[model samples]
Target: MSIEVANDANAYLGMKTLDTPNSNNYVEYDGNGHLTIDVGEHDDFDGPDTQPGEGVNSDSFTWFDGMFQLCNQGKAEANISYELPDPPAERDIPGNWTAPGDGYDEQVVGFYYISEGGDDPGEEGDRIFVPEGDSVPLPVGECREMGVRTVTKGVDATTDAPLIDGDVVVTADSPAAGAPNGTDPS
Candidate 1:
């Protein structure tokens, strides 16, 4: 499986870009039915530091970007697990500011499935709340196209700073035909 982080203009950090792996992006499911990817820190920024008592600078913002793909190598289906981090709050924002932080009330990390024709899967896609965790199922011999993103609630989709994102692919061998696929295959 291969994953590509979108290169949108708004998602770019001043001097710190996503430190994605140069190779080995594919995630294999272990016998325990779980796969984990550790996406390290936010990019390094070359911006002015705010001194004590100084207010928040408009340029000092958090940014987020992510995407993933699932490749089923086995004859059985499987589920992919991922957890989204909570949206930034007044306390989460890093700066010497006295004003309240612009909290993202309904922020979410969306996982969209793309059809063979490269069209959006629409309602069939998954949208998980930030700071929450969930999983999605993938069929055997199926290669699914998916796009992951972070956005604030109610407002248009925009990237934020101080964000970290990653993914994991899980599979179960010998899954009963037509049975549910995931970490808990009950």
Candidate 2:
């Protein structure tokens, strides 16, 4: 089990340069009821000191239930300090990445699809929130390319894993956020 953090201060940190590469990191749900992500940090437009706060770093238990279709990461009454993991060596941005949510004009740090109604509408396992504006329904897996900085970590099931360029298929029994007529799911 691992603890993750996504602080608000780090969501939107700076301007995306004209030549900047579109984020390749994303999350996906495998058609067989599993959501997997290639872990990494946000695009660091600002330096570490100016980046979002660190996450609590401590020993914790992390678990994912296939039956209930949930994923959890948290410390038992411990605060885990978090630091942005160093980006890959070849990228244009080379420091800890902050949240685009905090630095940019848009309220959404990234993009995601929320579940409208189902067995677990808001529950982590049953509901689905795609981080980068890819809209689809649950149980219907799709590859979405998106990114978001760590908002806050240490709390139970708060921050998701650092995702790299990869594929995920939503297999859990979750109803997509926008359904029928494009109404907000929350």
Candidate 3:
């Protein structure tokens, strides 16, 4: 699961893993879209080519949507990536996304972006805005349906539980309370 946190001015992205050193791992952010992680030397290993004089560098690179690009030896093949979607990505309405239903059954939802002028909502776009004491409709389309569900905070209901704010939400579309009412786009 992915978790997003606000630290001073940065947005720290944390993840859960049973393989890594810590059951949970986190990347430090600096707001300018930079994330830094310090895994011990034991965590990194050389694959094939290595020179006597050249020393391996320990560094972390940040990519779009919080993807961390790690490079060992100054080569493309030496690079590896770990991607974690930013808490919110600007998804066009009527697009496809994963939703969770009761018993944790995953469902696909087609959402229509609703705005003041029916235009594209800017960056961090047209997502289900869950406001306190308010009901929000699910984005419905040929891909999914419409429903009223409370957005999960820092919880990936499809994967992991809550840890922090800005986590991917889990939306259920079954016969339960927030099940989406589907519609045709044609």
Candidate 4:
């Protein structure tokens, strides 16, 4: 995420031009008319501020069914399918001695999918699991969100491992099922 794209990135953090090999974590996009939404990542690490697991973060209780949705992250309702990985959320650590974040997923990660309960619309309140191969259209300015099951160390983490990665494609709209002459009616 670039400082320009970060949801509340420090606006006054002046820099002497981020150029060349000195710039860390930089990517360039060609912008060929894609539904690429800048992840508004409105959340930040509340260190040790962890939410209790839904009883599936342990071997003694290894069952969980949850719902997730796609947020607008744009100015209009859009239908797009994208396979993205867990956000790279890095946190502060004490001292130079360190540990890597891997193999500890069950304790620190959450998995999300279109569970069979998706047919029930939602598991809790407005949190609906994504429909199979589909999305629940988001209103403009919605914050995109997702979850993935992983194991981890309690409270804190250092590095982030890749979860899911793929391309994003926006399909065209189709005519209403009973449209006459295959033409959509406003």
Best by lDDT: 1
Off by over 4 Å in 4: 1-73, 84-120, 123-127, 150-186
Best-fitting candidate, measured by TM-score? 1
Q: Against the true structure, candidate 4 has what lDDT?
A: 0.31
Q: In terms of TM-score, how similar is model 2 to the real structure?
A: 0.19
Candidates ranked, most accurate by TM-score first = 1, 4, 2, 3
lDDT of 2 by residue, 14-116 (tens): 1121111222222333444333342234454233456532332222322211111222111111111112334334332213332233233222112332233
Candidate 1 lDDT, tens digit per residue, 1-186?
Answer: 864442221111101112233112222234443433322322332234632221112323322222334455444655554444433452242222122235543324344444443232334334322223344555666655444443432322233443333332232334444455433346
Please write out the lDDT profile of model 4 over residues 1-186, one tens digit for every residue: 443442211111111112222111121123432222221121332224674222223222121232123344433444433333333345221122112343332323222434334343555334333322454443344433333333323324223422213343323233332366433456
- Point out the worst 10-residue segment of candidate 2 by lDDT: 72-81
- For candidate 1, the per-residue lDDT at 53 reads 23
Model 4 deviation from the true structure expressed as Cα RMSD, one decimal place: 14.5
Superposition TM-score, candidate 3 onto the true structure: 0.16
* Estimated TM-score for each candidate: 0.36, 0.19, 0.16, 0.27
Q: What's the candidate order when arranged by decreasing lDDT?
A: 1, 4, 2, 3
Residue 83 CA error for candidate 4 (Å)? 2.8
Q: After superposition, how far is residue 90 of candidate 1 from its true place, in Å?
A: 8.4
Give residue 10's error in model 4 in angstroms. Answer: 13
